[model samples]
Target: MAAIDEQIEQVERRFGVQLPEDYRLFLRSRTGMSQFVPPADDYLMLDSADELIDINEAGEFQERFPGSLVIGGDGARELLTYDFRQSPPPLVLLDTAASDWSAAIPQAPSLTVFLDQFPETGWIWGGDSR
Candidate 1:
């Protein structure tokens, strides 16, 4: 738990943005979750804080969407990210393959709401799953 907090702190420092409070709480509670397997073949799952930070720091994502933190993804192309630039922050789905930032879709208003919307099966392809 302490280690997770440390990792979260490190991410904030490196990214220059504070994570959503609910997300910070979530990380402190769980190490990681299973791969998201939504019905549409698209999926989303939480990543370890370390991997979360690493993905945000990666060249591909950085070159395309700066100031975005990759939290999870569809396991193949799309990415679920927290757009720090937005007030209150927003969870967005990025189309990685196309490298088209405009194609990004807003998923939730905040991390807490996003988690609540996750399916019982642990998948999140986007729907009224909550």
Candidate 2:
């Protein structure tokens, strides 16, 4: 697999925008979603649920899938995490799990697999972004 930075850069180049500083930092700090959990409003308020993803694995999502990351947070605070994205060849979802109470993505197979999604929000793990 490519280095995290390399993967991030690839996503940015393909998407045509620089991710937020905090987002970049988060990516640099993590390697995958193994350490992450669903966040509150991860499904209802953000534009791209993918936006709520850990920064570390963000690039991996981009590499696996190329379309925008929509995340909806508390009370209609919807926002687009990754805009205008796409997926790789022969789209498929990999290591993805979603249930009535949880959704976990070990690695995504394709971007299309993530549409119409909701994260296991209402609780979150990890330190403050502040």
Candidate 3:
């Protein structure tokens, strides 16, 4: 189901950053995938507004990966995030096993591009392909 504006506001307040237009639009349209959705596992399953805060806070992402916010994951080690380290933050994949900057793989130039191309591009674990 679509997320309410208040939910999005809570996320913004928790993260202390204004989300990109594309991402906000996504939230307005659909908060995340439902359990009944296909491609249920090991895929980029987006987190709900509350889940976004809980997961990021639990992981201590700000201290560990400054300027980054965990948006979703593969239900395991791989995480989908927005790298706020750059202007107009790019979407990236982070490995939980590796705790360094090198572990990050640039997925797309922006959330807009990622959402637009994900169906065709899919996930790339080997290296950066965007």
Candidate 4:
């Protein structure tokens, strides 16, 4: 696993934007995990630092949303992103087909709150099958 500082630097350099403190801390604690389910059934699993960078660098989403950094996805067409233009970086869900970022749904104010509210196993609270 990459050191937290190294990961932070790599992310900022590649994405051309600074990561929020909470998200940085989250990466420090959990650099990456495999096969973990998300709270939302419609969304895909959260990706590791390397995987996320790869997804963004592929230029598929970046070409559409230039400043948006994709942090997660639904494994289909939708993506969960951090809008770098906003202070503290609010999480937004983007639909790839329509490229309708103007209707982006705000998921959380910061990564810390996002994780705290929707933990790895948070789906259990709603009795959703994993």
Candidate 5:
């Protein structure tokens, strides 16, 4: 489902941070997806705008991830996130149970790249790139 500007703005207001332009564009077109089976064989479920707020707030993500936003996750222990600690806020894969930020693994430089190359390669794991 595509999200309107107001809905997107609501998400930003909830987090007190502007989402990356590329990600905003994604939400405009494909706000979320469910049970998207990629080549990695892991089921990917993207969160809708409302779900984003619910997930983040319910999980206390602000305290856990600091400058990052949880966009989606594998049904299990992994999460696809936008690490906002840097300019452009590169997307990353993180273990939900991670004890420190250093465990974040680089997944894509941007959401556009992630979608463009998603079928080719799903979430990347097992790296210490942060």
Candidate 6:
């Protein structure tokens, strides 16, 4: 956790933004690459929310849920599903950073985690948003 905090501090310094509470929690939970964007055919436990259908599938994950704040649609699942047992998106953490980074991107007013917001097969911010 200290390492994460250190990294967070570094990010804050670099971006001059303060992360939000929910976003901070999500970052602290998974300081590395999130476990939801890969393999394209397995149902992996995403976050503390609910199981999010795999976006790798027919791309229905984004269709069902659009303009969502959270990004959950990878892992090994076939369909997009929200996982309530995993952490939220890294963007959430950036939003919680209480720094300039938040100002540089979108945010969830209520921290309502969503699945479609995440890219099904791509990269964002060095894949941080993936």
Every model's TM-score: 0.81, 0.32, 0.83, 0.73, 0.85, 0.32
lDDT of each: 0.74, 0.36, 0.76, 0.67, 0.77, 0.35
Q: Model 2: per-residue lDDT, tens digit, 4-116?
A: 67766765665665655545555666542322225424432322213344531543544543454433222322122333333232111122222211122222232232322
C-alpha lDDT (0 to 100) for residue 6 of candidate 5? 83
- For 1-130, candidate 4 gives per-residue lDDT tens digits of 5566886788899889988777776677775543444444333456676666787876477777778988876566666689887776787767766464675766667766666665443322221221
Off by over 4 Å in 3: 1-3, 34-42
| Selected candidate, larger lDDT, 3 vs 4 | 3
Better of 3 and 6 by lDDT: 3
In the range 1-130, model 6's lDDT, one tens digit per residue, is 4776776565445334454465557667763244534434233333422111122122342233322223332343222222222244233222222222322232222233423433342323232433
Question: Which regions in candidate 1 have their CA more than 4 angstroms from the true location?
Answer: 36-42, 120-130
1-130 per-residue lDDT for model 5 (tens digits): 3347888889888777899887777777775887866565567878877677777775566788898789988777788888878887888887878866788888888878777777766667667342
RMSD, each candidate, Å?
Answer: 3.6, 13.4, 3.4, 5.6, 2.7, 14.4
Q: Which stretches of candidate 2 lie over 4 Å from their true place?
A: 34-67, 70-80, 83-130
RMSD versus native structure for model 6: 14.4
Q: How much is 3 displaced in model 5, in angstroms?
A: 6.9
In model 6, the runs with Cα more than 4 Å from the true position are: 32-107, 110-112, 115-130
- Angstrom error at residue 32, model 6: 4.5
RMSD of 5: 2.7
**Which numbered prediction scores highest in lDDT against the true structure?**
5
Clashes of each: 0, 26, 0, 0, 0, 42
The superposed Cα distance between candidate 2 and the true structure at residue 105, in angstroms, equals: 21
Error of 3 at 30 (Å): 0.8
Best by TM-score: 5
